[model samples]
Target: MKRALLGADDLFPTGGEAPPWPGRLVELDGSRLLVRDTPATAPGAEPALYVHGLGGSSTNWTDLAGLLAGRLEGQAIDLPGFGRSEPARRYTIAAFADRVIRWIEHSGRGPVHLFGNSLGGAISVRVAGLRPDLVRTLTLVSPALPFLDPRRSSQSRALPLLAIPRGDRLATRLLTRVTPEQMADQIIDSCFADPRRVSEMRRLEAVEEIRIRYELAHYIPAYLSSLRGLVSCFLRAYLPGAGSLWRIASRITAPTLVIGGRQDQLVDIRVAPQAARVIPDSRLLILDGVGHVAQMEVPRVVARAAVAMLDEVSRPDAERPPRPSRAVRVGVAAAKPGSAQVAPA
Candidate 1:
């Protein structure tokens, strides 16, 4: 298949000179946006649904969106409190999954393929497990599973979200002063294995949006509470907490593709084994030197793998592709210097 691409800045054309978007405001859950795209503009002709991590809006997937859009129609959401989406009253994993279901029902795009990064990955897994009927297949990039080794600094930030009483309100007050650059930096550090590849422009965009988020909500307390609940799903044991999605992984019957960055500090290398063990009919790919946000860190490689996985899922049972080996699965997706071939050499 031929690769589809819009040179760099071309993919993200919002407002002043942004690329023409596929659809705008299909629906508004409060203030957040439900964005959609079609392959008419994208190159690959691969249909997909993407989910971003915490504190991220659909914009986070801007470039990735355009890249994937080339293959097929694509839709991405700004989960409550993260992007243009307004925070819900409660931000639990199940609640987020509900919103995903709502979008699916509302869009009449049932059985769509799923892809997610970091916290988004956690939510994707939950949605697939809970609503297997809705997903054609599951693809996770640096899914935010709990750290076998705790991230002290990050843990401090996430703790209140899970355990502190009314901590969301306090978190908002504390983080309101957070700049988008700071937000971007933290995410880059936490999510990418090799953040150096993150362009200056991507950092700036994230910086701007993070600042905008603080000003959007009027019910600061509730928003904070809901934000906490949403993150708690990712921060609690196994990132979504124990018996949540991690436990659900073993029961997932979906054809799954799991990718992790060797550079990801948020969710470590070991988690891949856990995912491989639990997910039935699954393939695991670990991109070394890549971080939690492998998709962004190396869009081409990640996007290619994604399209291949989805395309495989879409094939007839007789044409399904073979599984990938652990050797082919490990390493940095973008920065590494080798092909990940699955067949015997």
Candidate 2:
């Protein structure tokens, strides 16, 4: 049965109190994925897909998806072993990318406006590079691209732990000591520039989500294996070969918008410039006082920038603005209203 689209009154619940969008299990290539649909508010809205970062679920895109409902009918997927999805056979980036490809193919939603964060950004890069025909435009939020000398973030420190033997056990033991509420606080501290920006309701919601995920048997293995897989990809990303993400970025034909936070602890903001430089047709936006999750930190600003990109792309070849010859840096001040400043790189 087809579900009714959310009306304007239902779109943005008071105090962001709306629960997650409705989701259904989808069978694709012998795997089941949980997908949450945020129906478009307009009749001719374009199809879009949202891929969350590692350790995140489809709910990560809730705010951003709701904000973009006027322009995009979005589907956010739970990669196997995360959210309500079943466990996967493997947790490698390629495998995850393949699953995303399968879903797009299965749904016949090719050439979609693709949005990804952190690990999902890495996966989306692979998808866009490998199958350009399936993507219309790309937006990455602090994508976990290869970083040779990764910044000394908490996440970087955890990488070594994942490399150790029986790391999953060690991780399990460590996680056992931390309550879901504490875990949520740690995540907020690490992912946001200022922890105070997170509402108490959101914090409670995060704790509840973490508590539920803790009960799942596959959660630990999935997280540890995925981290290890990402580390492996990092090591392999710099080797002399056509497989490097840098090389892949050069091959992307889609007009891309790369957003990063100046205060990002996990993925160094320095890499954002390099990412924009490598992607043939891409622009960069660096938000001051924002952290790893720009989409979540400033959905309205992200939405404005995203809508701008969509508008530019939808214009005819003659009407479209000329592509900037060099990288353009846009700085949005603490997501304040009308505080975005654009300057030539």
**Model 2 root-mean-square deviation:** 6.8
Q: TM-score for all predictions? A: 0.77, 0.90
- Per-residue lDDT for 1-345 in model 2, tens only? 010111233333234445678999988777689999999988999999999888988888878888788889999999899988999989999999999998999999887999999999999999999999999999998998988775635587677777689887888888899998888878888888766666666777788888998899888899888888888888888899888887888899998888888888888777777788888778777777788887777776678778777777788889965554554444545433211111000
lDDT of 1 by residue, 179-204 (tens): 65666666666665566676555555
Q: What C-alpha lDDT values do all the predictions have? A: 0.61, 0.80
**Candidate 2 lDDT score relative to the true structure:** 0.80
Give me the candidate number with maximum TM-score. 2
- Model 2 scores a TM of 0.90
Total clashing pairs for each candidate = 32, 1
